[model samples]
Target: MNFFSASYNSNQDLLDHLKSRGFLESETVYQAMKLIPRGDFLPVELLDSAYQDSPLRCSRYGFNASAPHIYGKCLSELEIEQGNSVLDIGTGTGHFAALASYLCGSLGRVHGLDIKSEIVNFARSNTETFKSKSGLNINVEYFVRNCFLADPDDNVYDRIYVGAACPKDYVHQLLKALSPNGIMIVPAGEELLKYVKVDGKLKVQYLLGVRYSELELPHQHEIQISYIQHEREKSLKVLIPKNGIDQSFRLLINDQKFSDVQLYILGNKTPINVHSFIFYCRIPSFFKEFIEPQQINLSESPLVSILLPDFVTEKNLMMVLEYVYCAKLIDPTIFESNNSSPDQVNLELDNLHETLLYFKIDSLVEYFDNVSTILQNPQPFNLFQDCQSKHLQMLVQSFNKIPENIGTDYTFHFKGGDIDIISSETVPHLLEISDFYDDQFLKSHCESILAKSVEIDNVVCLYILSSRLNAKQLFRICKEFIIENYPKVSKTANFQDLDKELLCQLLQDSCSYFQLLFDRNDSKIKSVELNETHSQNL
Candidate 1:
C-alpha cells in the first residue's frame, strides 16, 4: 500500500490518485465519490480547494469537510451496503451524506444531523442542488439537532458516521441506536476509530490519527419542551415495542400453552412442545416435514407429536430452538457451565455443530463448526524452544506437495501451499517464527486464520495477542468482535486484565491517544459533561 501520495489537480484526478494508493478499494465508493463533485458542497470562496486532497472549510461554524482520502478510508471501513439506513452525525455541508446516499442506492435512507441550523440548511440546499443537476436519486434528509443524542431505540441505523471528535461518554449512547451488526466510524481526539455493534455491544478498532474539532455540545437550557415533544412524536411512529417481536417468539419456546406440536426425542420421555407458526416462519423446510400426511392427524387435536432422530439431544434441541425463535445464539458456556466437565463440553459442542448442520441452519452451523474445529486442533507451538525436529517435520509435511527438494532449510523450499492452520492457538508462535524468517505468506495466513477463528470465548485473548504481535488486521477483527459482543465479552476474565491504555481506547475515550501530551505533574483535562436529551409525551 502507498502510505504517502501527492496532491491532485481536480476531483477525477484525486479519485484516480486515491484509487492508486489503495484508498478507494470499493467500486461502489469509487463511483459515488467520483460522481459527486465536492465543490458543490463547499462555499464559493473555498471552492478552489474542493478538489485538493485536503480538508476544506465548508461551514462558517468551524466544520471542515474531511479530506477525500479520509472519506475513502471511512467509506471502506463502513462498507455501507444497499438498503442500509445510515446516520451521518455532524453532517456539515452533506458532502459525505451525498456520497453515502449514492453508495447505499435508492432503496436506502440517510439521515443527516447537525446542531447548527445554518449548517443543516446548507447541507439540505447543497444536496437538493446536486440532485437537480446530476439527476441521481439520492434519498437523504437533513435535520437540525444535537449531534451527540442518538435515538434510544436499539434497532435503528445500519451504519453511523460521526464527523466530529466524539467524546467517550457518548459512545455507549450512540451505540444504542445502531442495529446489531451495524458499523460506526468516528474520530476520537487524535485517533480515527471504527466501532461495529454486534449482539448489542461494540467492537472498537483504531484507524489512524487526525485533528478534528470536538463534537458540539448543546447547552443545558436548550432542552426545552419543544424538543421533548419532537422526540415523542418520532417515537410514536414505531408501532412495535423494541425487540417485541423477538421476545414474543422467544417466550413461546417449550411453552405448552401455545404449542401446537410436541417433538419426541430418543431416550427422553417428555416431548418438547413448540409453536408450529414459529417453525413455519423460521424453517419452512422443517415445517414441510411437520405437515406431511403421515405426520399430521387432523381428526384429533392439532397437537401432533413426532419422534426426532437419536442425534437430537435435549440440550442441543433447546439451543437450536433459541436460534429458531429469535435468531439468537445461546451462549455456548451455558451448555455445561453448572454440571458438565471439559470433555463433556467439547462433546456437546461437537454435537451442537452437527445438529445445526443437520437442521440446515447455515450461519449457526458455520459458527459452531469453527468453534469445535479450533478447540480440537493441536496446541500452540512453544516459541522458547529452538527449531525442533518435530516442528520441522510438521512444516515439511504441511507442504510435502511442493516441487522443491526436501532440504535442511525447509523454510526456503516451502514457498507456499495449501497449509491448513493446526489451531488458532498456534497463531502467536507462528506469527513470531514467520516474522523471524520473513515469511510473508505464512504470516498472512496465520493472521487470516486467527482473525477468522475469533469466537466469543477467545476473542479477548486474541485481541491481547494481536496487540503483542502488532497484528493490525487481526487486532481490527478482534476489536470488532469484542464490540459486537461487548456485554458477553466484557464478562470474560481476560477483559478485566486488558492493559489500562487499551481498555481506555476500547471505551472510545477521546483522550486515550493524547495522554502522551499530558504532563506527569499537571492535572489532565476535565471530562466533557454529558447533558442527555430527554423525551416527554406531549
Candidate 2:
C-alpha cells in the first residue's frame, strides 16, 4: 500500500481500537475519523505511530498534537453539520480541521489559528494534499495570532472550540464571539479541567479528571530574567483572586534580623471588598497564620495577620508592610473563611466599592452595580455602607450624570406655550450609560429616539437595543418602527440578515423557524439555518 493508504488503514484500525476501549460512542464519528488520514499531518518519523491513541510531541517545545481519541471526542462534541462555520483555536497539524472539513461537507467553512507561523504553513501544505488526494473540496483558513487576546471584530461564530486551557477572564471574550444560541466548548480552571459551554447561558461539565497547563501570555526576555530573580528569594505566600492568579507575585527576604515585623496592607487597582491585609509578620513561621483554611465568603475582605517577635523594630516592620500591601492591592485574592456570614459579604462589597473609588475605576463601578443588583437586599447594602463602602456614592454620582436630553431626538419642537424648544447633545450619554448597565427600560426609550433621528450615523445602536429585548417585544418594536417610518429598510439591508436570525432565535418557542429556514426553498436564509441532522448527531 502507498503511504497515504497505509496511514488511512492504520487510523481506521486505531478507531476500532478506541471503540473497543470505550473511548468512542457514535459510528458516524468513527467513520469520519477513518476517512481523514492522520499521517498526512504528521512528521515522517511520527508517521509510523500516526494512528496511535496517544498524543505525539511535534515540536522542540512541549507542543503536542492531541491524541486521536481526544480529537474524535471534541469533534463528536461539536457535532458539526454540512454547512456550519467552525473556528478551531490552537490548530496543531491540521488533523482536527481536516476531519471537520469532511464532516461539514462542501458548503461549510473552517478557520484554524495557531501562534507558530511554521506550523500553520505546514498545516496549509498538508490540507492542500489531503484535498487533492480525496478530491473533497473544503474551505480552511489559518491565521497566526495570540489566542489569549480578544479579536477586534465581532464575527459571531456558530461553533468555537479552544484546544488550550484559558483563564476565567478569557471566558467572557469567547462568549462574546459566539452567536446567540451558538455553542462553545472550553477547558477551564487552574488545577482542574472543566468543559464549559456558553450556549445562550453559561454551563459547565467536568470531563476529564486531569488538570491542563494554564494559558499564559508570552513573556519577554527581560521579564523572564526578573522572574528568575524573584523566584530565587525565599518564597512568600501570596493569595490571588481567581482572575488575578496569573498576574500575582510573592516577595521573599533573606534577612533574619528583622524577621518578625509588623506590617500594614493597602490596595490599589484591586477589586472592591477583597480581604487583604495589614499586619506584623515573621518569615516562614508567620506564613502559616496568614493562610486562610478555606475560600473567603463573597462578603469578607482578604486579610493577612502575622504575630511578630518582640525584638523586631516597628519602623522596619512598617516599611515592609507598606510594600506588601502595595503588592496585595495590585493583585489581591478572595480571603477564605469557614463561617462566612451575610454581614461579611456586605462588608467586602463595601470595601471593594471604596477601593474602586480610590483608584477611580469608572468602568468597574458598573460591575459593582451588577453585583449590588444580584445581592438585592437593604440590610446587606446598609451593612456594606457601615463599613464605609463608597459604592453607593459612586452609584449616586453616576446616576446624577444621566443627562436630561436622554431618550429624546435632537429636533426643534413647538411647545403649547408658543415657544420653540431645541433638543440637546447630552441625550446620547444616557444611551451610553444604559448600554453600560444593560438597563432594558432606558435602552428602549433611547433606541426609539435614535431610530427616528435623521442625524444618527449608525443603526448598530438600535440593533444592540433590539438584541437585549425578547423576540416578541423586539419584533413588536421593530414592526412599529418600520410601519411608521423606513418601511423598505429590511429588504435592502444585507446586514439585516444576521439581525433577522437573532430575532428568530430569540422569539420562537418551537423549532419551526429553524425548520423553515432549513427548507431548500429558503436560499437567502439557508446560510444561517441550523441543520437538524447535525443536531441529531450531537
Candidate 3:
C-alpha cells in the first residue's frame, strides 16, 4: 500500500501520534481536524496515510501539503478570534480552511484558493463534514485560481494565511488583502519561519527546526527585508509646555532630520496628549555631551524639555531619534553601549559613524567632519566602501553650498589667556552690536542662521529661527531637505498651516513654469476641451 493509503487507514493512530508531539493543542483544532476526513482530499494511492503527522505528496514536481504538526503550529500562532474572515492561499486539503472556519464561527468566513483544480475539489469534498457538524454554518469557499495575483474587486479579508513557504515579496499582495488589524501567518525564509502582518508589524518566533517544500507563486518582485535581531532601546515620554514659545522648536542633529521621537504631554496623575515625533538623534543625549556650556544655559530656559539619564553618543542618539521620528521601532540592542571613558566613547563613535554611513544618513558625514576637526584627526576613507556609493555621493553633493561672505571689523577685549578669562565677561552692549553687524551684512541672514541652527546640536536655536524665517523659504528648504535627506521625517513633523500654503504656492509656481515650457498644441487643446465636455455630460 502507498504512504497516503497507509496513513488514511490509521487516522486515529496518526492523530494520537500528533497529540504526543504536542501538535494538536486546542480542542477546537482537534475536533475540526478529526471531522474534516483527510482521506477524501488525498489521492486513493496515498489515502492510507492522509492523517499522518508527516507531509504527503499531493501533485507532481514536489507540490505537497505540510505535516500535521506544522499545520497545527501555524494555526496556533494565528490566534484566531471569532468573526474573522480568513483567506488561505495554497489551500491543499482544505482541512486548514475548515479548521479556520470552525474557529471563526457563523460570523466568520474562510476563502481557500489553489492553482490545482483537483486539489481545490478535493478540499471542498473533505470539508463537507464541517458544514453539517458545526450547524453554526461556517462558510468555506474554494477556488481554483492563482493566489499570488489578487482579484482587484476582493480586498475584504480580515486574516490571510499563506500555506506555502514564499519569498518576502509575496507580503505586498497579502498585506493588500489584510484589514488594518488583521494577522497573516506564513513560513518565510529557507530554514526559518516568520509570522508577519500581526498588529501592523512583523514578528518572528522560532519554531522547531525543520525544512518544508517551497510553495510556488508568480514572478518574483522587489521587496525590502530588514533583518533585526531582538534587542530593546530606551524610551522616554516628554511633555510640551502649554505656552506657544516652544512652537518653532523641532529636533535635529548634524543636519539630519529627527522627527518621530515620542513627545508626550504630562497631565494630572498620568501622561496625556502624546505627540509622536521622529528625529535623527536623541536630543537629551546630544544636549548632555556635544552642546557647549553656554548653549546649555539657553536650553534650560525652554518651556519643554526631554530628560534622559546617563550619557549616549550623538550618533546612537540620532539613530534612536530617526527611528522614533519615522514612527518605526528598532531593537533595543542598537542603543546599548559599553560605558567606558573617552577612549571607549571614541571607539563607539567610530562604529556609529560607520553605521550611519551604511544606512546613508547624509548629515552624519558633516557630523564626522566636525568631530574630526575637534579630534584633529582624519578618518579612514574606506570605512564605508561596501555601502551604496551613489547614496554617499548624493550626501556629498547636498553639502555643496555657496559660503556667504560677511565683511566685518570688530574688536574684542580679553582680560587673560586662561586664568583671568573667568574673571572677565564679554560686555552685553558689544555683543549686541556684533549681532546687529552680522545681521546687517548677510542676505537672508536670519533664514541662513535658522537653517544653520538646525544643522548644529542647538534644538532651541533651530526652533526659534525656524519660527522667524520667511515661510516660503523655510517651507521650500524643509520640504527639499526632508525629501532628499530624510523622507521619514515628514511623517512626524507638525508643520504650521502657513507652511502648507507656502508649499501650494511653490507647486503653483512650478506648474506655471511647466506650462510655459510645454505650450499645448491647438489640436491637443481642442481634444482636452472636448474630453472635459464629455466628462461633464457623463
Ranking by lDDT: 1, 2, 3
For candidate 3, the 10 contiguous residues with the lowest summed lDDT are 226-235
Q: Model 3 lDDT vs. the true structure?
A: 0.48
Model 1 per-residue lDDT tens digits across residues 1-538? 3334345568898889889878889888999888897888888888777777777765575688888889998998899999999999999989899999998888998999888888898899999998999999977888876754434342378999989887776676667667889999988777899998777677899998888888876542332333443454443231322443345456668888655678888988888987554454456556666543433456746566778877789978988898776566545656666688888878777777777766666655545556555346424221111222333332233323322222223322232122443245555666654443344555556777776678888898888877776666677667767766789999988898889988877777324313422532122222122212222322
| TM-score of candidate 2 relative to the true fold | 0.39
Model 1 stretches astray by more than 4 angstroms: 1-7, 59-62, 150-155, 199-201, 219-538
Model 2 worst lDDT run, 10 consecutive residues: 410-419
Maximum-lDDT candidate: 1
lDDT tens digits by residue: candidate 2, 1-538 = 4322223247667777677756667676787777776788887878877876666788643467767767766777677778877778788788788777777878887888788888788778888888888776756888876664444333566677777777766677556666655666676763223333454466665555433444555433333333433442212111112422112212122222212222323332221212121111112122324432321322353232333333333333333333333222111123223355767655654565554443333443454556544345322111010111122122224344543333222111100111112223543554454444333444444444544552222333344444554322333444334433433544545335546665454345225433543443454334335455567679
Ranking by TM-score: 1, 2, 3
TM-scores for all predictions: 0.45, 0.39, 0.38
> What is candidate 3's TM-score against the reference?
0.38
Clashes per candidate, residues 3 or more apart or on different chains: 4, 18, 38
RMSD of 3: 22.0
How much is the lDDT of residue 96 in candidate 2?
81
* 346: Cα error in model 3, Å: 70
Cα miss at 536, model 1 (Å)? Answer: 36
Model 1, residue 368: C-alpha shift (Å): 36
The list of candidate 3 runs beyond 4 A from truth reads 1-9, 60-62, 129-136, 154-156, 192-199, 220-538
